[model samples]
Target: MLQHIKMYGAIVLAMIFWAFSFIWTKIAIESFQPVTLVTLRLVIAVLLLYAYAKATKKFQYIKRADLKWFVLLAFFEPYMYYMGETYSLTMLNPTLVAVIVATIPLFAPLFAFLFLKEKISPVNILGIVVSLLGVMMVIYEPQVGVETGFWGIILVFVAVFSAVFYAITLRKISSHYKTVNIILYQSIIGLFFFVPTFFITDYATITDIKITYKSLEALLMLAIFASVLAFVLFAGVVRKIGIAKTNVFVNLIPVFTAVFSWLLLGQQLGFNQWIGIVVVVSGLFVSQLSRKRKISEKIEEITQVTEY
Candidate 1:
């Protein structure tokens, strides 16, 4: 029971940190370019994660054979995913961005089944349907002259796709490497990718620009809370309870993002948005619980048969 509770808490905290990312990226992007912000965040995060890994003596196991996969993971995640999201947030509202990014759970299973040949249970499909309903509710409201740009929405969709791809890729790569090594190498590779892009895109003008304390704080928060801590907790939970169970926690991200935006940014979500949150949460719980229950019952039946 206590172990289950800890798992649940870890999932919840992970979602909260992810939600906070929406808020932080919104602020930091106000002053910096998308790739520039990403570059800076990756640079700081790589340094920090390396230090943590070395101080704890966790950095020595990355084999040369695994380097290619790490670089590939970095390409999908921090480079493509972060760049897409950072650009989208600059163009869209935080809540809208959250809603779009939250669609990953709905889409990831499909990609996983297609690419990784991972099974998607019927319950998971139902959860995806319900979660999609919730996402639609959050974004659907008639307004005069409310223009959601097509390009921004497209960017967020791509971000979601990138994340889905990364999760599927992670399944294959995690088998060959420790999560720490995977993340450590990915961050380093991502930083490598980010540097040249930053130079070509924003470095020349960055010297003349003023860096606001608010932006610095937001970027730092993105590095520490969203990037470092969230990934660590997620890796730990995956190690403990397995990734199948750990994934359902992602459904809570949109909920926490909405709540935080309301409290901190004074953003108001409409009645329909609240309903969407409920639907999404319900679907996720039902989907995960149903699968677990079925597995437990199968185990019990096996035990009974053996006893007989």
Candidate 2:
């Protein structure tokens, strides 16, 4: 019981860090270009992860055959995911971005069903439909007479799909590698993708760069808490409680983000947006019902099979 509590605590803590990451990314982008911020963030994460791996002697080399999988993971995640997310934040509010990202787990199971032949229940399908409606509500502002930041919403969805693909790729290599090693390699390979993009896109603006305390603080927090610590705690929780149960904690991210953005950034939601957030969160909860039911059924089957 105590062990379970601790694991739950860790998961919540990770969620808090991840929730705040949207705000941090928004702050960092004020001073750095999106690609530059992502590259520097990855560099910090890589150095921190490398030091931890070395100090603990937890390093493992990827088999030459499996190197491609890690490379692909890096491409989808720290590279593409960060690109989509950070760039979108430049155009969207932190709360809106966080709400969009909160839907990641809602879509992950669908991708799993598609790629891994996992069974998805009817409830999952309904949840997707409902959540998408909620997204539309959030993005559409009848008062403004336009969809709020349509391009930004589209880019945030790009991040969402990038993350879903990242999760899919992660399952392939997770069994073969430790979590730290996976993060370390991803961060390193992600740098390869980011460096060229940074130079091509933002190199000219580098000379005018003036770093402020707020931006630097945000960058370091993103590196330490969001990149390194959150992943470690989440991976650990997934190991202890299984992904379905572990993922329930993810629902709290947008809630936390909403509160943090309000408190820190003074961002406020309109009445319709609040309704949208509630609906989106409801859809997320609804989506998990099928997964929980499936897990229960699987356990029952295993029990009966064992008895026989």
- Choose the strongest candidate by lDDT: 2
TM-score of each: 0.83, 0.88
Q: After superposition, how far is residue 155 of candidate 2 from its true place, in Å?
A: 0.8
Model 1: residues with Cα > 4 Å off, grouped in runs:
1-11, 117-120, 141-147, 237-249, 292-308
Worst 10 residues of 1 by lDDT: 299-308
lDDT, residue 234, candidate 2: 79
Count the clashes in each prediction: 0, 0
RMSD of 2: 6.1
lDDT scores of the candidates, listed in order: 0.71, 0.78
Q: Write the per-residue lDDT of candidate 1 for residues 28-51, one digit (tens) a residue.
A: 887878888888887887888888
